[model samples]
Target: MALLQNLPYVPDTVRGRTVGRSFQAVFLMVLVSVLLVGAFGLRLFQLQVVEGDRNRQLADTNRIRLVPKRPARGTIFDRNGKILAGSRLSHTVSIWPIALPRDKWPMVINRLSKVLNVPPDEIQKRLEQAGYESIESITIARGISPAQATALAEYTNELPGVRLEAEAVRNYPNGDLAAHVIGYTGELTDEQLKARREQGYRLGDVVGQMGAESAFESTLHGTWGGQQVEVDSAGRIISILGDKPAIAGKDIQLTIDIELQRAAEAALGNREGAIVAIDPRSGAVLAMASWPTYDPNIFTTRITEAQWRQLQGADHPFLNRSLQAFPPASTFKIVTTSAAIESGKYDPGTVLPTYPYIQVGGIQFGDWNRAGFGPLSFPGAMAWSSDTFFYQVAMRIGGPTLIEMTRRYGFGRKTGIELGAEESAGLVPDEAWKQKNLDEDWVIGDSINMSIGQGFMQATPLQVANMFAVPANNGYRVTPHLLKDNEEHRNWKESLELSDATIDVLHQGLRRVITGGTGQSLNVPHLPPLSGKSGTAEAPPGLSHAWFGAYAPMEKPEVVVVAFAEHSGGGGGKVAAPMVLKVLEAYFKADQNAAAAAP
Candidate 1:
């Protein structure tokens, strides 16, 4: 090595040092190579073993999706199986926003707007409402027509991720016919969602807003179903991993006789009034009608603000006058009659002098007839609706007795109909109620007014029908309902503490009302024997309200019908009795035809 260093290329011991340095460099390089390989192995183990499950889940999330499917709502039918409300198959347009480039949305939406016959601004509005970071498909249009759906299908190749989804839309065949009873459906409000969130009511859920629809929401709104799908990066479905079929809602049948309902509505005839007819034996409502009504079908489509405002007219078309309370007029005399007989303070033989006017608290309350029917008994007094006669009877029996009897007959309270919040518990004034609400003391005049169904006393047409229903049903106060043969109503009636004598007196008095009294207009010879009472009530600031309540086939009464005409100029004998006659004719025409054919 020394001789080699001394050569021209090397110095003394440089060759030895250079050889040592070369070996050190080789060793150092090998050590570094081992360290690098070990580090890489450790990192590879962590990535493949420690966090592998989490990374796999993250990868799956990018391609897997859950799509919800809505179930069909229940159908509503009349007692005769006529479809009142039903559901129709409809399509909704949806889009997987991420499937198409954001920049291309304007062009796609524009073309879709033409096919949908909707404004482009509306589509853009819906998309913006869906937020930019939404992972699920967004709804572009709901309840689209089949023609529009077909047109969209033709352009699906150009529209990328746009597609059609199946849905159920509510449909009311008869436009305005039982609008109050059937009610309407609308989107779930934020408050409703908050209240029903845990019950699986989602943000976009449709719910019943009023009437029987609201009362039976859970029974009508069916369960939701969903599918788990696997998709590619462009949001294209690769396969459906799992799917669940939705459960359909059950059908509901109402007790309404469509024929009777039509007749009742026709009889009402644009009057701001209500008519109710019920089967006294079963308490099944045969017909209920209110005028100034709206087309519930308008709610099925997108209702404009103007149309909605128009529905809330001054007369209040939405007001179910059958369920709403008003001055009951002479119809309320039935309550006083019950009180008089039940209290044992008065009898059918009890006679009182009825005058043209009665003096009470220095106020002269006049009778409808200028010359009162002279010294009439209870039967005669009730027949003529002698306000002065009842005034004396009410004072003798006391106001407490009348108020108590009113409640017993289902007055001053809701009739428990399935119409829900649409019902009004009408005002029944007494000493305590007057003191508390009106800040006035109850006096003899108040009792006199109460006897006549005037002065703060109010009642619904349903309650009036029920009042007559009690006597027609032979002392059992039935709970009126719209469900046909409802098991719940089997034991719904309460047996009153009335005696046979009281029922007889009631029948006798009501019969006299039709035979020769104020309601003689309804006492046609060709028709079955009828018992009824006609009333003319004083309503200040407007004309008196006309009221008539009647039940036919006096021996075994089957039906009770009540008619009311608000602010009608004429008396009940002339105005409301005719309406009742029309409905009764419609109801009995079928029976008459059957009898005629039987001969």
Candidate 2:
């Protein structure tokens, strides 16, 4: 009543109009309020039901993570079960960018650097280079010690989003025994990562970079596995939602013989040289030693700048000389000798003018002997390394015929061995090749020089070994391999089409090489009459590349050994043959030891 009395008094008509207007205004206000409340209710329903699962998924993703579980790396062993390369259990520390607090990144990196012995900037650089993914964990450091892992784990609460995972890293037991053939493993380069990412290669995955390791990478790389874990905002794992076990990589058995390899390396002994031995029957490489080899174990972790520079220095320790090409010198005469007999143009008894020098295409080429063996037969020419006689043989058969012969024996191409990307396809140049490459006309002098294994002709020591091997095996050549039983090889044999008479003549010539010729030094009394050819190639300024190639026991060739001593002055018989002899001596001694030990 007091509140009503405070209002101004009104007449009957004014009161009626005011009361009606007030009722209208109140009704409009009530309607607007009801509509707004209904809109709010609809929006709330849509948010709680229609968009619920999606929002929950986004929230869950913020806390959930997948961690890679690395499997054991494949073990590498010699055929005799001696471990050449194995794996050791190790740990890798990783970090997830999405779960890591942005403000604390510098602090985390700084702390990690102390334990990892890595620069903070380096860790940051690797992170930037990898281009972090929301769900993926970037590897902070690899091959961490157990102590380091424990230290990291002790502070897990503070080092949010970091994890330590057990992994298998490559280890070499024999050090540099068969380094070139066994090769080394390393982290993938940025280009390699880009190319292999689709195949499940991650940021920190390691891969074989050379030799058999690289050739068999696809077979050795096992499937990767991981665990999906639920975590809190602080990155503490609450539970594992799912887990998959990683499969170990397939172990590899190599045809390499550790004993023979060691013996060959020892014989090379700080010299810049190479020694390669092969089983002629199977074409399986027994030992391949390139001197000044490196330790594959050093490659398991990060290679230091100084170590890399040392490897890249003048010695060229990485070069597998067994697969590298050089002038065959007198050893190349075998190809000419074979061509002569195969062409049926010259018989073993065919005699040539014993001239000290020969002239062709307006050029005079001197014989190896200044006072040449006058009027020598084909056998005599090969035994004495008569350049004059070979010159005529080259003229008789022609360049095309010789090139064809070389191709038939697997020259000018890779040997298709298990050691990938480390072989050289020795050049077999002809008129057309010379014309295209040197932009010059082919001359008869080129053919003459080629006949003596010179002038545009190049052959790797392996090829040179194969050259003798073809004749030893009755003109059947097998693909050379390093794997114990490499199924990748097709067991392909190239038919050399050598006549029995030609083989006999070649055998006789090679026999005389040991009997009373350039390779006479190889005729060991205890050994069963070895047959071989010697090479002394002139490379200028450093002594000729001394080379020797042979197969044991003239009656039946069981193995072929080839040796090359780079710029080591002296004939093959004087420098390289002794290396091959030492290898053979060890080979026979091992066989004898095994035979005697047998019951």
lDDT of 1 by residue, 311-394 (tens): 876989988899988888887788888899889888667888988988776888887786788998878888888888888888
Q: For model 2, what is the error of residue 69's alpha carbon versus the real structure, in angstroms, after optimal superposition?
A: 1.6
What lDDT does the true structure give each of the candidates? 0.83, 0.83
Question: What C-alpha RMSD separates each model from the true structure?
Answer: 4.9, 3.8
Q: Candidate 2 clashing pairs? A: 354-375
- For this target, which candidate reaches the highest TM-score against the unseen true structure? 2
TM-score against native, each model = 0.87, 0.90
lDDT of 2 at 45: 81
Q: Candidate 2 regions off by >4 Å?
A: 1-47, 128-133, 145-157, 486-492
Off by over 4 Å in 1: 1-51, 95-141, 146-162, 485-489, 592-599
Highest lDDT scorer: 1
Q: After superposition, how far is residue 461 of candidate 2 from its true place, in Å?
A: 1.3
